[model samples]
Target: MQHRPQNWILILDFGSQYTQLIARRVRELNVYCEIHPFNKDLATFADNPPNGVILSGGPSSVNDENAPNINEDIFNWDVPVLGICYGLQILAHNEISGSVEKADRREFGRSELIVDDNTDLLKEIPEESVVWMSHGDHIKELSSNYEVIAHTDNAHVAAVRHDEKPIYGVQFHPEVVHTVYGGQILQNFVYSICHLKGSWTAKSFIESTIEEIREKVGDDRVICGLSGGVDSTVVATLVHEAIGDQLQCIFVDNGVLRKNEFQDVLDIYEDQLHLPVKGIDASDKFLERLKGVVDPEMKRITIGETFIEVFDEAIAHDDSYKYLAQGTLYPDVIESISFKGPSATIKSHHNVGGLPEEMNLDLIEPVRELFKDEVRNVGRELGIPEHFIKRHPFPGPGLAIRIISDVDRPKLDILREADDIFISELRKNDLYDEVWQALAVLLPVQSVGVMGDERTYEFTIGLRAVTSVDGMTADWAHLPHPFLAHVSNRIINEVRGINRVVYDISSKPPSTIEWE
Candidate 1:
């Protein structure tokens, strides 16, 4: 079994969009936490109970016929329990069926929270402060065993606590920033009430991960695919530290990478980090399979399948390799096990999903439980260069999805040049680290434009730059107009890609970061 921190928080997710945010907040306190579906069997954690339990808010009302019910087993654990918006209502409804009902005035935004008592959960919070409220239902009456700890003008039961148990519930969302003292309230619960120390840090994680990897892959050879990205690099470094020369890493050039990215990344893998690595130039093979593939889904499948084939060929003669290590992160794991059911297919990832099944190898994902930023921390702890650690996230499919048309050599060349200019200018102007991700897309639409004094019809290049904490949601970066003009002029003037350039101004809801 993988080694995890002994003292951690178990967050039961109720299909809330903000559920992940709660986990993020907990991890921000340097306390480890994991999110599981609301209906998960508590018996699974019987051997290793969490230090505390947090019930996340959801969209469903407790009165609904099919509303998600509470797993009463949590209380049996005898651990400190805290519930937010919908969570609070569920606790009350569990006591009496009709205890929670629709409110006459729904609170959707900020409100003044009046503190009736500030002994424990509400400790350090001000008497009157702004708190965010998004629920439409409110508790009509509290159980005789529970006492009111705080209230608001619209919600008398804004906060409640059990008479004797260390259980608490709050109508307002303390996981959000809108709440004035939200962090303080959570600190109070995590530290004072649950008595958990903030000891989960980068150094501890690296030490534990190396030991676990060593135990799991003893005397067995492991093969890892390198994408030159932070996650894979960190995984490779960690595995190498555990088993040294027993880990073999392969970096494949898929023909769709950025300009000079293949050699540049390979040099770092060999020289800077000094891991056992092999650079495979299968660009011709990848490009041949990608020819005439116009649909984005097909493009991703082609790349993923091609990747598996190349990796399989590279290791076909080596029967000693028994494990395949991937750079899968926590968000991907959470989305796979979501209780909300399968969401619509926006775009398929380019990871080699079929590698293990085809290659007959056990899988190893050391950072599978860490978020993107957390992986960066692990990378830093492993002594990866700071510049490489902060590199913007690149899709596994590379420039395939960026081109909104059929893949081809000329188109790839045009995109590479345009993208190089945009990215280089961002760094030159000290704006590279400002945005989470920035890229240039080659649009299929061709428009008329004038360069010098001639009318020209050429494909337009779309420039996208976004500010985001995680790629889950993003807003278009409001770059300085003058700086954008400079990049646009350079792309149009330098790259021979006929004419026009445009900037994407849409956010993640209606439009994704990539055009495809």
Candidate 2:
């Protein structure tokens, strides 16, 4: 049963990527919330009604023949409502008589939100506050009950609020990092209008998730897939604390792991934390299936499917392991099953199946409710090593796909050496935390360059350094030329099999930072 916290906010998703961000921002305030499709009957969720309703931004235009719309009953509901982007347009069309027109100046990118002198929705958002906009259609006319409260240079009606009802609408997206004070605006909505209690913190999530896991697992033995990331470390530590010896953590050393990552991770869990863990070196198995696989998607699938096979084999040795536990965080779970399940964020972070379904074991996730940063906090709370918690984001494929071309042991070794040097330099300067992600990709195409008067054809190492809040969007980090020069010099001079290095400067829109 979904626990309904006081004064909940119901988010009706319209298939916008930003919809989950809306719920995330609301949840950040400790206000309970739920997300559902726009067309879901209001009564379907009214058994535990939200204190307020939020309509999410979407791709479809309200004028489209099949555009999604909120339930008509939502209008009659005695609660506050806030509509965003396409949501605002839907509200406009439902309340007013005119349809949305394809905009001559379709709003995109960052803009200043000029607020009306008298409006509560824009109450503390400040005049000329930064906002992110993405929409092609504009509300041409206002209904009798709706009044234009805020506007942008391109959008005449950036925001609207009904004077009589607690309904408000905005054409701009306030749920993204691009929008300054966007969080404050959402805080205002959650606190002032929805009348929610701000008590949902990492500690609260930890307690609730632990209790839920205990109830589900009962006396059955649980197997935790320790992925050696902050997510897995925290989850395994929590379950260990909860069930002690009954919980067994299986840490698979997929051959594609970062250079020496297998042993280093094993040390932390077994030696440092004294965890009930077994380190399985299935690198040979994983690398065998991954040979010559160039497509990134295929690489992920192969690794995922292989992990399931290896884990199943391990569990076979101990029939007592009845539960298959994972360190799946909220973001990963949300995007994986969003279209099919109740999660709003899962539509974004699809962690393709790492395990096969035939290994049918009762599923248990201790940290399913936690986000990335929150998982780190819980790791610290559970006495995990600081170094493990602060480690850079490591994709589960290990290092196979990080090598932009064909997967090979020699190329993998060189790339790891270069990556280690890059990370070491970043750490020496205390710049690791500042960088969102920094990795070295070994480009397949070798260039001819004279080294010590000897004709040499060596692999080029592509250096990617990006700054991002979430991987969904990112900007290239401007490492001081001196730093880049030092890293390039070290990789070419100290590390073998590389003569050239290039810095990736493109942002997330044009580039994903990862070469592959």
Candidate 3:
């Protein structure tokens, strides 16, 4: 079990794509929230119940034969409850069978919500405002025990409330940004109805995490693998604060990292952060293992196993280390786990899914439940420098995955030079902090290009930059065309082995941030 805030909200997820978004919104209000599978046993939190409960939207329909159902025990807790999208339908189905059914036309986009009663959940929300709707099933008839609080033109039962209890439901998604009053509506529910104090701040998390780490680790030494990314840096600093010299950090060059990344990050860890760290250049070993590995999954697994081997060999001389700490985040865990059942694996993250089953040391992830932005917030509270805290997220497999082909030293060198130019230009143009993540992918496709009045065949580089609140969902950053032209010119002219450059304009649902 991990350390949790005293006043927190419990979000029961029914496999919604936006389940994490709901948690993010709640956390934005300064109230801590956790997402658990809908069928999770409530008895696990019997001693430490949440101040309130939120049912997240999902892709499942309540009328389905094997649909996810509501836990009746939630009512027994007597906590304020708010249901969203599919959550609202399930509640009505539980109250009265067959109350919800398929709609003639699926509502999949923005819709104006008309608030009829602005007493509780809809309190302070605009009388008529845009609300995001993405549901095929709607509450056709609410139970007699419930009253309609709000409605859209298409969805009469857009929002409903129980006659007596502090239970409410909404058909529209309040977690998405498309909903104009979404944040305010959630603020009302969490603050007004639930009476939560919104006490779960970065400082509070750091204080509790420090105490918990010390208690769990005791006098045993801990070894942490630093990736030079924000996540690992924050973890090392937080752990170092708790156990001081008891923690040992190791940063290895995997032969696929950005140019000068190994040494640059090592300097920050040792000099700037004052953490006990050792830098190892195991690029040759990593590159040897990755040679001829073309499949993305295989590449990830190879790098992960190679990383374990390096760490194990580095600490082989000493058996004092009892724990292995990583900077695993919430998205990594969510995307890695087949939480929705079999075939739910989106892609195996190097840190989360690439690890071997058995290891010599126990795993301790300090920020396992936090999102990328949340981790940055924790970094700021921990006194990490502002510039370091805002660094773009670097994948664990490094440029290997970005290569989009088999691993090799020549390919690594090409990618490193190209990526350095892209990143350096972003920083120089004052656009580094504008996007969430940006990288240059060395595509294997080669075409004839005219350079110095000569025809030459060279590799291509794909530029990808995205804007996102968290890494879970993203939209390609709309960088200026002139800026793009300038970066493209520099990459092709300065870096060798590159002919063409293309910009990715796809969003998360259609295309992920990374090509691989």
Candidate 4:
């Protein structure tokens, strides 16, 4: 992947979800950057050089003997360098030592960043600004050459910088929104140090991505997996516009969809968009393979494996197809940064996982460079419908993860109907778009209830609706008591087997939006 001699930055990924976010922030500054594995050669960057470099946070602890690390040459690259989270830990280890591990007291949430009032890094930020900290280890000691530039209540070395060098490190994750001065910190690195011009926008990304797509794909046919999610839909649309009708989208219905989702997705993606989309109704195949599998992890693995088989078989006859286009957004790339380290939440969302190793085709990830909001901006540029652009977040596993206790069709259908009513009422009450995501889960727990003179034993359905800027952290939607009452009544009255509905009011940390 040889990028042009443009204003480029290189993001050294240590497998953190914030890696792509780091790149997105850079690109937002109109300075193009590419993410590479830390083990990749750092010297090639000497000639076709990036203006600066950033090291991404990872899921691994710096104290772990086998933790992923960047080559030391990164510090000597003669350019500005920024290290984040595990990136900071690795840097501290490479130079300094004794970053104490506090596994029992990991800094996993918001913290106040106590910065040196005169420091350049905290240029625009206040001295004691709030920042997101998510690491288990802290710098107990620093290298003789490095100095502590920032601190927090718990960790003395929240940030470090070599006095004589351009390299810098921050223990807290400045890429997340929880960090009050995160964007300012990133801007200081980009504008003040690297001096990158903030000229990049969604328009620029679209034009450049289109040109790149045309250059690589040429006359070859490309097959995209359209999930009807904003990321995939935008990617499919952008590719179609780039190559005209050469891109074929194979949408597989994995029997884990929401109520009437199969048709709704097709209608919006196929008919409305006028793209070359083929709806492969492989619901039965997926359902059969998934029978009696109740474990959430097992369900994801099986669904991912079977989806490959289904997608592979669906496009096997199209001999001209040589590339697989995915709607993989910046978050997807950032979230699965390690490619090996699974998410902390254990909830497999936004990922279909990696394709089979022997798929033998190149991957076309058009929107892989844009964030969720940036993708929507590009969608607006491409004339996408506002409703489609602003739709609520749905898990990549579809409805499989929402059903708490079972994966049977009868239970799935019931869950789907109950979920539809819940969401529809949210819409009718003008509260749908306000929430980040809303879903009804079928609980395995059964309870006795009386309805119309008969006693019934049925599963419970839990409803969750949240409001968030992105899926990273969310707060429960504040429903008017009357509205909640109306929604509860509709689900219990209209959807059978669900005599009870409970609303979840927890945030993302303690409770993920999904029940399972």
Q: lDDT value for candidate 1?
A: 0.87
Q: CA RMSD for every model?
A: 2.0, 3.4, 1.5, 4.4
Give model 2 RMSD, 1 decimal: 3.4
Per-residue CA lDDT of model 3 for 1-516, tens digit only, reads 276777999999888888888999999999988888898899989889998999988888898889999898999989999999989999999988998999998899999999999988888888899999999998888889999999988988999899989999999999999999999999999999999977888899999999999999999999999988999999999999999999999999889889999989898887888999999999999999998999999988998888888889988999888888899998888878875432277788888889899888888899998989889999999999999999999989999899888989888889998899889989999999999999999998999999999998999999999999889899999999999999999889988888888888899976778888
Report the candidate with higher TM-score, 2 versus 4. Answer: 2
lDDT of 4 by residue, 1-516 (tens): 132437778888887867756766676666777778777786767677778888888888777787787787765668899999888888888775555465456788988888774467778788788899888777777887888888888888888888898888899887876888888898898888888887666777778788888999999998888777888888888888889888888788888888788788898886688879889988998889778888877777777677667767877787888888876654455444444234333444334353454664577877665557777888988888999998876766788888875588998889989888888888887888878778888888888988999998877888888887656557998988998888888888888897877888899756666765
Q: Tell me the whole-model lDDT of each prediction, alpha carbons only.
A: 0.87, 0.78, 0.90, 0.77
lDDT of 2 by residue, 14-118 (tens): 888677688778877877677777777677665667788888988887877866766878866788989999888998888764658899988898998888844
Candidate 3, RMSD to the unseen true structure: 1.5
**Runs off by more than 4 Å, candidate 2:** 1-8, 15-17, 32-49, 73-78, 103-119, 125-133, 151-156, 176-181, 333-351
Model 2 accuracy (lDDT, Cα): 0.78
- Scored by lDDT, model 3 comes in at 0.90
Local accuracy of candidate 1 as per-residue lDDT tens digits, 1-516: 355688999998887767877888898999999888788888989889999999989888899988998899998989999999988899999988899999999999999999999999999888999999998999997899899999999999999999989999999999888998998999999999999999999999989989999899999999998887888899999999999989999999999999999999999999999989999999999899989889887887788778767777888998888887878777655543333332334544565332323546677999888888999998988899999999998877889899999888899999999999999999999999999899999999999888889888889999999998766668999999999999998899988864889999999866877776
lDDT at position 57, candidate 1: 91
**Per-residue error at 506 for model 4, in Å?**
3.7
Task: Kindly report which residue pairs in candidate 2 clash with one another.
Answer: 30-200, 255-283, 334-346, 335-345, 335-346, 335-347
